[model samples]
Each structure stands twice: as C-alpha cells, then as structure tokens.
Target: MARPGPRPARDHGRRSQPRPAPRPRGRRRRAPHVRERAVPALAHEGEVPSLARRRLSRLSRGVPARLRGPRLLRRALSRDDRRPCARPEAQARLRGRGEGSRLRGAEADEVGLVLGSTQDRHRGGLVSGIRLERTGALVTARFDKARGNAIDEPFTQELLQVAKELGADPGVRGVLLASAHPKLFSPGLDLVTLIEYDRAAMERFMRLFAQAVWALYALPKPVVAAINGHAVAGGCILALTADYRILRRGGVQVGLNEVKVGVPLPWSVALLLRASVPPTALTSVALLGRNFADDEAIAVGLADQLADADGFEDFGRARLEEFADKDTDSIAITKGYLRDAVLREMRARESEEMDAWLERWFSDGTRERIRQIVAGMGKGR
Candidate 1:
C-alpha cells in the first residue's frame, strides 16, 4: 500500500550520528599555554601542588589581592626585606648579596656579647689531685690522688691551695668535697710516703696537712662532704671538716683507724673526732679505731645522713642548699666563734704534737707495725 511510500527514499550508503553540543563560549577554555607554564613554575619553586594550595590558603587570610600570587611571594623571598628565618644554612645561602645580609652574623654578635659578660660562668676544669667544677652558686672539688686519694705531701698542698682559692672566691656560694675513686674516698695518709720520710719531711707534711684541713674547716662558705667511698683515718678527719657529711650507703666504711694500724692519732685528728662523733661513742670510734658502716656512722653522729652511692652528690647538694638563705658573712662569723678555740688549740700544739708523732712514727714498734700493714695491703690486692 504504501507501495512506494514515495518510493520515498533510496537506500543511503551509511547512517549518520548526531554531533555533540558545542561548549558554552562565555569563558573560553583556558589555554594550554597557561596550564603548562603555571605547573612548571610551581615545580621549579620546589613546592608541591598540595603544599602550594596550603600556602595559598594561609596567604589569602591576610594578604592583599595584589600580593596574593606566587610571583609576589617569590619576589619577596628573593629580596632581603625580612629576616631569612632562623636556619643558619638558609641564611648563609641568602647572604650572598653582601655582608650586611648575613643574619647569622648579628645573632653571633649577640651571643658573643652575652658570653663576654659572664666569661666562663659555670665552667669546669682540673687541678692536680682534684677536679673543680662550678655550677651556679655551687663549686665542687673532687679528690683524685693516684694512691687511693691518700694524703701525700703533693696531694695535701694541692688540696690546701684549692680550698683556699674556693674559700676566697666571692662567686662560689658553697663548696662540695667528693672523691673521684669509686671504692675509696681516701684510705688515709700515703704510708709508703710516710715510711720514707725523715724527721724534717714528716714535720713539713704534718704542718701542711693541718693547714689544709683548717682551710676547709674555716672556709667562709658552707662546705659539704659527699663520702661516696671509704673514709678511713685521715680521710675521716678530712670529712669531719665539712659542715655536713653525707655518706654513701652499702659496704662503705668510715672512721679513724689509727690505733688499729699502730699509729697514734694526731692531736688535730683527735679534736676533729671529738667534735663530730658523739661524746659517748668517741672512745669506741677514736680510741678503738673501729670502722663503721653508713648506718652506724650516722647513728654515732659521724655522718649527717646516709645516701645511695649514686645519689651522694645530690644529697650533699641538697644539704648545702639548706643554708642557701643564710647570710655567708653571718655564717662565717658564727663558725669562727664556734671553731676558734679548737683551731687555736691545734695551732698552739701543732709543733710539739708533730714532733712527738714523728718520734713515734720512727720507733721500732710502729715501723714494724706499718711494715706489716703494707704487707697485708699488698696481699689483699
């Protein structure tokens, strides 16, 4: 019927498809040139796209529209308008423009100014037979003698000098005495040296030894002893000079053992023991020459407190700080009043006492006893 619906159309060789609609022309797609240039510039500036976005967010909060772009940021960083940050290397790199652009130089100058004003504040250094360190108002002197920190002629002289220097230093508010040895604060006098000494040598040694202890005892500032190890004989006498003595607990022994070694106690040594040890225990502590452990020492008033070995110095420091508020001049005056009699007695009797000690030391019985003691020490070692 439609029989020839118009014989309408003749067959076409291919079917046609509809075309896509044209994009709106309002903004005209961004040119490829713009995208390519922008991406590479950001890449060259060592900023990742995400980081750049974050920076842009931060900049947008306060930057004017005219200064909001990456071009302005780059220009500002390149010019020396602001500090180049705290990084030294970065500042160094940026300082190539001229010496005036060196930020670190200014910082160094400020630092030098501060250091110059204080000199070597809080500095630490060494002296023979001891190490001295300064921290704030506290100064510490550590005994480091070669022979168990034994009181030898040289050791005594050095210690005496150090004590005098620290006593005279206005900057040092307090002094802490300690031993560098782990097991022996000091084993007393160097017997080997003593055995070799003649009357003159022994006299000189004893005089200086007395002076050394007196220096510490009379020191204007407070002195604290950190007895981290054995303090026997003369070592105990040394500790007794301190305002406070803190003993390390566990296996450490302290006392005047002169009688046990067949050596009679010096007059000064006897006085020190009488002053520090309880009067009731003085006979057993000094006469019997018995050694006491930390607890016993504390019980007998030979030590102020018992501290763990690791914390001895800290304990001593705390003890010193207890007097931090006391006027140093007042303390010196009071201590002088309390100790003047003892010091005077020692000074008055030193010559005669030392002569008698030298005579006893060279006696056949005492010399024989000392030889045995040295032999025993050698065997123990």
Candidate 2:
C-alpha cells in the first residue's frame, strides 16, 4: 500500500475517440499476402544453423506451398537489403515458381545465383546441406553444411527433393554429388542429436534416408561422387549410391562403420553396398566397419577412380562428361539393369530390415554407446 502497488498499470482504451482511418491514396495497397511467407522470408538472412533448422521444420509442415508466389516473393525481393539480393532473372525464377518445382526453405536467393548464373555469385553464399549448380549438361550438388555437413533430417530431405527435380529435368544430363569441404565430405549422421531418438523417430529418419539414397541410386542418369574428404558411416553409403566414385587419394577417411557404433546397416544401405562393393570384399567392408584408405577403398570397389588433391573436381567432371556424351537413354537403361535389382531387393526386405535395425538402435547397450559418443562430440566441436 505504501509503494502504491507499482503505480497501477495505465489502461489504454482501444479507441478513446473516433480515430481517422488510414488515408487511401490513389492506389490501394494489396495488404500483405507476404505475411504467410513472413516466417520463411525472415529466415533468409544469414541465420544461425539452429535458427535455420527451426525454419526448415516450419517448411516441412507445407510452408513452401505458401511460397509467397510471384507477388510475395517479388515484393519481398524488391526491398534492397544492401546485401546481394535476388537479381531480376533470379526473381523471375522464384516468381514463376519454376526453379525446379519447389525451392527448399529460404534458399530463394541461393537457388537463383547457383543455377548456373555465374561462378562468382555461387561462391558468395553457402547454403545449408546441399548446393546445386548446373555447369553445361552436368548438375553438381555440393554437400556443404555447418559442423562438418552432418546427415540430419534437412540433409536427407533436401537431397531427396533435389534428386526428384534433377530426375525430372531433361536438361540435366549427368549429376555429380560431392562435398564442398576441402577435407571432410561429411561426418555422417548427427548421432549426437540422434542418440535421443526413440524407435519412431529413428524409423522416420531411416525411412527418409532410404528414399534419398534410392532417389540418387535410381536417378536414371549418370551420378558420380567426388570423395574429396572423410566419408564415414552414413557418408560411405551415400558415396556407394553413385554410379562411379572418384576418391582423392590423400588425407581422406572413407567407409561404413555402422556396426562399430552398434547400429546395423538397414536394407537400403545393404543394397547400395552390395551393388557398389565387390562381393569378395563385402565382409571386410561392411562387417569390420573400419575406415578404408585410398588404395584399399579402390581395391574394395568403394571408389572407382583416384584423383589428386587439386584435380578432384576435374576428375568428377571428366567422368560425368564421358557419360553425358554417350546415348543417355542407353546409359540409363544399362544403369537400370545393374541397380534395378538392388532397388527391388531393398524394397522387398525394407520392413524386416527396419524392424531389426530399430531393435538394435534402441537396445540398452547401444544407448550407452551412443550417449558416450555424443558426450565426446560436444568436447571436440
């Protein structure tokens, strides 16, 4: 009472008197259809990785369908942010909603610059997960992300979506899947976060991962992997999906180490391994779960060719070009002949494999192992 209860809150009436409405000019403002895309548009600025992931979560719920269309996207882009905003040509792509069907998250800016517009522009902004650039008839998807390009939900989802787009586009003659990191292709799955996944969560991720890999494997076009860095565990499986893999022979660790970490390889991964690795070397490659060196990876058929440190990109491009010059239809048919079997086998055994995988993933011993690994990860990065 002596303090007067903090001076009592001031009450502002909704309308103290009849206020004049907003003066209408010659033209009426279209209000804001852009509000629907407000969340994603705000996410476009150089957002932190944690914030980016949250924005992507919203997109997964179908925010992309509300992509602000031409009106909203153009309106949003018109404002000069003093940064490298979307150019007119780029704006048209986003406006028409024709940049490969659906653009992921707020990649609206990056998509325009990276779609073979210019090299200098592409180098300026690094998008999360995968970055696709079309040079000539080949489309190169560089796997670049923060914290060593971990295989999270965003990674797999973007990959699958891009695969679908490239597969549908007739102009894309060949595809190159590589890592943007100079010395680390990918650290594989985000096991730190994944350690907390229950059976259902694990199943969902595994399912999406399988679809992404399958899309890459069955793309009906020549796909090459430039393994210029460490491709471990899940990363190794990604490389195995490609029709040909060119590995940089020095300072790179590559292989499947799923067993060592307590999770068994799922059916889809098994198919990819079987298709890529030589039958004689499958046991050592899949069972031992150790990183294969340059020569060993090649000998085991994990890699088709070897490239020097500087020539990694060229090495991949040359292979893709060689394939592109051929009769594409015949090439696709032959690839189908080899990999279609794997797809069939993977589909047939998907259920049982997932069942077994989930059982092992949630086991008491595995949880402890995962927890220990996750704990160690925080200390390093």
Candidate 3:
C-alpha cells in the first residue's frame, strides 16, 4: 500500500541539464520611410556638376543603406543646404551641415581626417573621406568593389575633395591615392552622361569639377598617387594630379584615353596633366590612348615611383613624408604661385567653351566610336 501510494516517484530533482533556450526567429527589419525629406542639397559652395547631381541621384538609389559605403555617405550627408551661388541663408545652412555628418558612420574608419569646411577655420570636406594610416604616414584605400570604381563624376569629385582637404589642412603633410578596387583606378567617365545629358549641363559640370581640381593642385602638401591597379581615362587624369605617381610593378595599365573615346580632352583636364607631366612625354598616353604598364608609365614620366602592390603604400608614404617634412610655408606659397596662372586661365575660360567641348565630344561621331569600343571590349558601356 505504501509503495502504491508513493508510485515510484520520478526523479524530478535529477534536474536534467536545463533545456537550451529556444533560438530567436529574427524579424525582418522594416526600412524607415523618408522622414525628413530634405531635397538633396549641395554640401559645399563650389559648383556641383549637373552630371554629378544626376549620377548621385542614381547612385543614391540602388545602394543598400548598410552598403552605402562610408565615404559616399559622408559626402552625401555632409552637403551644405545651400546650392552653390545661393542666397546667404542657404550658405549659412550649408556651413552648419558641413563635414560633421560624414564623420558619423562605420565608413569613417577609412577616413584620415576632415580637412575642408564651410568656415575658413576648419574647411573639412576637402579631406573628409578615408585616410588609411600605417604608422604616422597616410595611405589611400584600394578598390573593394566589382564593376570597378567607375570614373564617373562622383568618383572624380571624391578625388577632388580629398585633394582640396590636403590643400586646406596645414597639418596633413602627405597623402597616397591607393585603390581598394581591383584592377582599379577607374574604368572611365559615364558614357550615359556623355551621351544623354544636354550640353549646358556638361559644361556646368566641367566648371565645377575644374575648380575643384584647381583647388587640389594648389595644395601645399605633397600628394602621392599609389596606383594599386589599372588607371583608365579619367582615372589616369586623377592619378596624374598627384605630385608623385607610384604604380604596382606588374598590376597597372594607365593613360588618358580621350582619343579612344574620339573626344578631345577638356581644356582644363589637359592643362592639369600638362602641369604634372611634360607635354612631349604625355603624347602617347593622352593621344594614342594606349594603356602603358607600370614600367612604361614610369618611363614616360606618368609615374614617379614603382613598387609591388604589397609595398606600394609603405613606399609612397615614405615619399610623401619626405616632402611633408619640408618647410611647408614655402611649399604652400610656391604651390599657390605656380597655380595662379592656371587658375586665371580657368577663370577666364567661358562656360560656353566647356559646353561646346562636351557637345562635340558627345556628338554622334564620338558616341558611335565609344559604343564600338565598349562593345568590342565586351564590358557594359
């Protein structure tokens, strides 16, 4: 009777190892609606090319919020409320918006410092993107995307901004233009903009971009381009803008390719290259449209130094610091003086001239040639 009452009590106290907690069934995150839909505003006072506006519009879409990339997000968010040449209130808004926004996210890890700002004191956007450093020297980020880093206007603007920061910052002694993109410098300009946008917009775009280039060239600090990979067309032009060009020994192919596009070089772009490399030496690179290997580029003065991709950053930084360590006062003053004449020419050039340049370049003849070449290469045009 006692046994029946007890009924072989189960060992409840045995306390089997606690069953593992159930795994969470994650819910999909809902994308927030655009709450504060501010019209895309210019981040700075200088002109933003219409081409850039259009390109940015397209780029802003499609890109995943998380994948928007730190540098680009900073550039977009750092925009000033004022359109260039806008009313004072607009300018003030822009000043307030400044590079502060760009410094907010994950991508910030890539940037070295904020160099350009609306106010003269901090002018931060000029150097607001990535600034990879090893030791005290500065380094550029290599290209990390596929389809390559297109040398579209936005990409060009990014380069210009970096240069502007370098010019503005008295403290930034040196910089390197390294690609995180594979086989990268850039593919070329957006053929779509060349063909689709009206001529006037193209001219406006050039003017804004030219001014930015001028700002970069005038930077007192030494700028080194570490070509981690290929540099085509606009990409080549960007690399040439640096004071010293270093290419990875076996992995680079670089040159200005306007001729291949059947387009004459924009005057301002031509002038930039001329200022950096000797005219005679640049002929084949610019006109023949042949992409030279690292050795050939160095032979023609397209590159000042060469190294394997592994050591390129280290070597470039050493060179940059060498120049950075110089008397910066002299450096800044001399750069300004050297660039004065060019700036005068750029300022004197007509907006119409730039428009005409784009018109002729994008006319039927050039368009067909570009189409043919792009088709031949089997890459999306």
| Whole-model lDDT per candidate | 0.69, 0.71, 0.59
TM-scores across all candidates? 0.66, 0.71, 0.62
User: Lowest-lDDT window of 10 residues in candidate 1?
Assistant: 112-121
lDDT of 2 by residue, 346-369 (tens): 878887678888989899998898
The regions of model 3 sitting more than 4 angstroms off are 1-146, 192-194, 350-352, 373-381
lDDT of 1: 0.69
**TM-score winner, 1 or 3:** 1
- Give the Cα RMSD of candidate 2: 13.6
After superposition on all CA atoms, what RMSD does each candidate show versus the true structure? Answer: 26.9, 13.6, 17.6
Off by over 4 Å in 1: 1-127
Question: For model 3, what is the alpha-carbon lDDT of residue 149?
Answer: 57
* Strongest candidate by lDDT: 2
Number of colliding residue pairs in each model: 1, 0, 26
In Å, residue 200's CA in model 3 sits off its true spot by 2.9
lDDT of candidate 3 vs native? 0.59
Q: Please provide, for model 1 over 1-381, each residue's C-alpha lDDT reduced to its tens digit, 9 standing for 90 to 100.
A: 445443333348554555699867553432323323434333322322232233335544544444445563432221211122223334455565665343234443332111100011132211136655444567667786676787787678767877787778786788888887899989999897688888788888888999998888878888889999999888999999998888998978988888876767888877777777779998889788888986788888778888886666778887887775588888888889888888888788877888777777888888998988878878887
Candidate 2 lDDT trough over 10 residues, lowest sum: 117-126
Candidate 3 lowest-lDDT run of ten: 112-121
Best by TM-score: 2
Model 3 error, position 172 (Å): 1.6
